[model samples]
Target: MCGIAGKTGIPVENIQPITDSLHHRGPEGSGYYADNTLQLFHTRLAIQDLSDAGAQPMQDESKRYVLIYNGEIYNHTALRNKLPEISFRSHSDTETLLHLLIRYGTDILEELNGIFAFAFYDRGEQQLILARDRFGVKPLYFRDELPNAFSFASELKTLRLLSSSPLSVRTESMLECLMLQYNLTETSGFREIERLGPGKFITIDMRSQRRQTVSWARPLYTRQYTVQTEADWIDQLDTALQQSMQRQLLSDKPVSFFLSGGVDSSLLAGLTKRLYPGRQLDAYSVKAGAAFVQEGFADDYAHAVSFAQQIQCRLHTVNAQPDLIHDLDRIIYALEELQADPACFFVSDIAARAKDAGQDVLIGGTGADDLFSGYRRHQALYYYNALDNIPAGLRKAGGALLKMLPAGKVRRLQKLLRLSLAPPNERMLQSFLWINRSEAMNLFSADLREQLTLDTIDTYCAGLLAAIPEEHDPLNQMLQLETHCFLAAHNLNYLDKIGMAHGVEIRVPYLDTELAKLSALLPPQLKMKGSETKYLLKKVASRYVPEHIIKRPKTGFGAPIRSWLQEDAAFRENLRERVMQVCSQWPEYFDRQQVERFYNDTINNRTDGAYTLFALAAIESWLRQFTAN
Candidate 1:
C-alpha cells in the first residue's frame, strides 16, 4: 500500500530521489527520517487511518524504533490484544506492527498474517531489518556492493534511483528472462540489484557492519489428509476462503472486484456480494475488442455481465484493443524487468480503468490456480505419470500415436513424455520453462551461445530443485515450484508493478495465511481429482456461483497474443521493427540474420515462436529505454 526506501552508512539526501520516484505508489503523503548511521523514506497511501497519525517513517511512543512499512497487517487488531501493556497513540497498523516487533522481535512475523515489505530501524541497536511477506505478495529490492553500505526499496525503479554509478546489465538474467519469461533466482536483471526472496528477512548492524539473511517462513505441505470426505473438504475450503476474504476486506476504503468471468474471479464477486450485502461492490472485466478477440476465446465481457447481474453487483468493462506498438514502450518501462507476457497490457488496462473509476483497492484471484492445480498442463502431467504403470509395449505404441497427432497436442504429449522420463527434481522445472535448452541455444547468437556453454543456464535452477524437501508430495513439490517460479517471479511481480503503476492496490484473498495452510494440508488427489483440475475449488465455488460458471473451461484472463502476432499486420510490423532495432544496437549479442530468420518463420506460421518473439520485443524495448546513451 506504500513505498519504502532506506540506507545505512549513507546521507539521507542521496536516497530522496528513490522516495520521489515512487510517489505514485503512495500519493497521500510522504515522510523522511534519518540519524547519523541510518535513514528511511516513506510514501504513504493512507489505507487504514486517513489521518496524520497514519503517516509513516513513524515511531513508537518511546521513539527508540522508527518504522517505514508498506502493506496491511490484517490481524493487527488481534495482535494488539497480545500487547495490552503497551500504550499507543494511533490506530494505524503501522503502529501495531511496531509494538508487535518491539515486544516479540522478529518472531512476530510468524505470528502475524498480512502482506508487507518493511524496514525497521532499531535506534537502540543501531541496526536495520528488512522483511517481506511469507508469499512475497509485496516486492523488495536491495543492493549491497558498497562497503558498509546497504540500500533497499519497494521497486527496482526506485532502487535504480539510489545507484552511485551506471548499473551493469546482467546478461545472464536477460537470457533467463528470454528463455523462462522471468528471472530464475534473486538476481535482478541488473548485476548490482538483488530481490529478497519471499518469507525471508535481512538484518544489518550499522556498528559492526555485519549483515545476515535468514528464512522466517516455509509453507506447511504435510499432506495429512485431515478431512473425512469431499463434502467436509468443501466446507473447510469455504470457511478458509470466507475467512480470508473477511480479513482482506479490512481496508477503510471501498474495494472493488476484478471479474474475468473465470471461476476464480467470479467466486470473488459472489462472495463479496454475499458477505457484504450493503457495500455495493463494483466488478470490472476487460474485453478483447472486435479486432483483437481470438477464435474460441471466451466472451469474458458477456459472462462478466451475466455474473454481475446474477450477483446483483455493478459491472464495469474496459474495451482493451490497445495498439501494441504504441503501448510497448510504456509497458516495458513499467515492467522494468523484461517479461514476455503481453497479458501485462491487459492487466494494466484493467488497473487504469479501476483507478479512473476512483477505486483504490482491487481484489484479484491469482494464487488459486497454482495452489489448487487448475491448469490443463497439471492434468496432462497427472495422466502422464500414470503412463509409467502401463506395459512397455503399450506405452511405446501410445507415444507413437501421440507423435502422429497434430503439432499442438503432439508437442504437449512429447513434453509430458519427456517429463515422465526426467528425474523428479527436473520434471517440474521443465514444465514451466518456455523453451527447451537446445531451442534457447539456437536463438542465442553464436558469441552468446559460446558464453552460455561456459556458464550453463540450468545451474541456478538446479540449486532450487535440490532444495525441495524430500518429504513433500510430488504434486506439492510441483505446486511449490509453480508458486516460487511462476507465481512469484512472473504473475505476482507484474500484478504489483502494473497495479501500482495505476495507483491501485491489488489484494489476493486466496493467498491468505490461513488458506495457504489449509491448501498445504489437502491431498494432491483432492486438489485435482482424476481429470478435473481445481475439483475441490469448483465444489466450494458451487455454493455461491452457478454450476455452469463453476464448470466453465479456464480461458485465463489474458489477451490472445498468438492470434495478434499472426493476424494483426501492424502489430507484427511493430514487433519486427523493434527486434531489428535491438539487433542493430547490440550486434555482438544478437545476430541480425538469425533474428530476422526467426521473425519470418514465426510470421509465416512455420514455427511456433510467438512467445519467443514477444519476449524479444519486450527485451528490445527495455534495453532501448534503460540502456540508452
Candidate 2:
C-alpha cells in the first residue's frame, strides 16, 4: 500500500505540499512527475519490492505513460507471464501495471484483481485515467473544482490542500453521518470534494478538461445465481481460500493477522500458517478489560488465545480499555469520516501497537460478512422473509400483541414489524439506519429543522435502495447493499484510514477479486442455511479452524460503548462535557438544549440511545476537528 496525489493544470510546487502530507502512508520513498498538464506524486511503502526500482511515478520504457498508484496487485506475476516480449525491470506489481497499460490501455482493469486507486497519465494521448478497485477497499478522493485545476489523493485530508478557502460543511453529510454513522453519498463532509465509487474509472482529457466515467464492474446482485452441489461448492471454496491467502501473503516484510477468535479471522490465520509452514507467523488480538465487559458486549480474548495456541502462532494481546477523552481528537481527525463503530478506535490502537512492534503488513478478514450473511441482522431478515408469508393483518396484530412484553423485546418486535411492512427497497435501509426520520426530527431543534429538509434523508436512502438489483432474490439485494454501502463505504474506509494512520498496511484476503466473484455466485441459501450464517464459509473453515471456533456465535469486534456511557461516571461526564463544548463552539449545526437532552438521556439510561449518542459525539468531534478553525 502507498499514497498517490497529483493535480492537473497546477504547478509542481503547489502539488508537493499535499504529497508531503501523506508521509504516514508511505515513509520509505517518494517521487514526483510534473509537466505543464499534470503534477503527479507517489510516496512508496515498499512492500513487494524493497529495491529502489520499485519506486513509483514510474514511467514505461517509451516514457509515454506515467503511473502514480496505491495498492497491491495479487495477480501481477500471472499478468506479466501473458506478455513475455516485454522485459520487466523489477519484481513489482507497479511495473506489471505499467506494462499492462502499455499493451491493453484501459481494458486492463478487467484483468486486474487487487485493491487499488491509481492515476495513470498517458503522455501520448494527454489524458488521465483514475480508477479504484472493485470494492473501494483503497480510498481515492478528488477535489475537481480547484482554481484552474483538479486534484486527487488517497485521503480527504490531502485533497483539502487544493483549496485555500475555509471548508464548507455539507448539512446532508452531517445528517447522514449522525444517522448512519458514515456519509451515504459520494460527496464527503466537505462540499468541495467527491469520491470515486467502487469498480469505476474515469478518463479526463487534458486538452478539453472533460471527464467521462467508464464502468468496469457491477454489484454482485446483478449477477445470476448458480446452483451447485454442496460438496463441489465447498471444494471450490477451500481452493479459493488457499489461493487468496497465498496471494495476499506476498510481502517482503513480516505479515501479522488480527485474530478476532471469530471464524473469519481465525480461519485466515490458520490458512496463513498452513500456507507457509516454514515461516514464523505473528498475530495480534485485542482484549477489552474486565470493566469494559458486558452481557452482550464481551471480548474474544479467551477464544483468540486458544486459537493462537492451537495454531502455534506468536500472539500479541493489547488491552483495549481506551482513554477515549485523550484519544478522541486524533481518532476522529484520522478517520476523516465519523464512524459510530467504536471498533475503529480498537483497530487504530492495534495497528499503532503493531507498527511499534515492527510489523508492516497486517492481514484481516473484513469482507466475508457482507459477501456471505454473517450478521445477526441477516438472521432477522431471514425470519422476516418467513413472516412475510403470514397475512399482513396477522403480522400487524402479532407485533401489537408483543407490546405487553419487556421493553427490549417490544422494541425488537416493533423493528421487525416496521421492516416487514416497508417496501422491498426500503427494508434494508430501515433495518440499518441508527435513527428514523421521526426520531431525528424529535432530536433536532426547530431552527436546525428549517435549514435542512427531512426529505433529503428519504431521497438518499431511496437512491441507494433503487440501485439494488431487484431481479435477484431479496437476500442477494441485501448483500449488494451491505457490500456496496456498509462494507465498502464504511468498514473498508475506516479500516484503510486507521491502519494507514499508524503506517501499517492492512490486506483483506476475503476481498480477493477471484474469491469474491466465486463467493458471489453461491446461492443465498448456501450462504445462510436456515439460521446458520456464513454456512458455506464455516463448513469450509471447519477444515482449518477448530470445531468449537467454527461453531461459536458471531460476536463481531465488540466495543463497550454502552457500558462506558452508562457505567463509567467520569467517562460519561467527560464525553458529555466534550459534546457540549463542541456544540458551544459550532452552534449552527446543533441545538444546545436538544443536544444536551440527547446526551443526558443516553448516558443516564433514560433511553436505549447509547449508539445514537456515540454518533452525535463523533459528529461533534468531527466538527471540532474540521470546522474549529
Candidate 2's residue-wise lDDT over 415-473, tens digit each?
A: 77867987766777677677777666655556777887766556755655466545457
Report the lDDT of model 2 for residue 615.
75
Candidate 1 lDDT by residue in tens digits, 1-629: 99888777656565557777889899888999888887788898878988898888888877999899999899898889999998777889999998888788899998779889999878888778899888888889999856777788888887777665678777777677767887753677787889999889998988888889988986556446575788888998998888899999998887899888888999977987788887787878887765444534566677788888888888888887777678888888877787878678888988888889888999999999989998766786677668777765666666667765543325566677766766666676677776677665666678887775523345655555456555366677777777777888788888888888887899999888889888988888889888888989999888888877887777755556667777778877787888888788887677788778877876765555677777887888888887774
* Superposition error at 186 for model 1 (Å): 1.6
Clash number for model 2?
A: 0
Top candidate by lDDT = 2
The superposed Cα distance between candidate 1 and the true structure at residue 70, in angstroms, equals 0.8
Badly placed stretches (over 4 Å) of model 2 are 12-16, 164-166, 291-295, 389-414, 454-470
| Candidate 2 TM-score over all chains jointly | 0.95
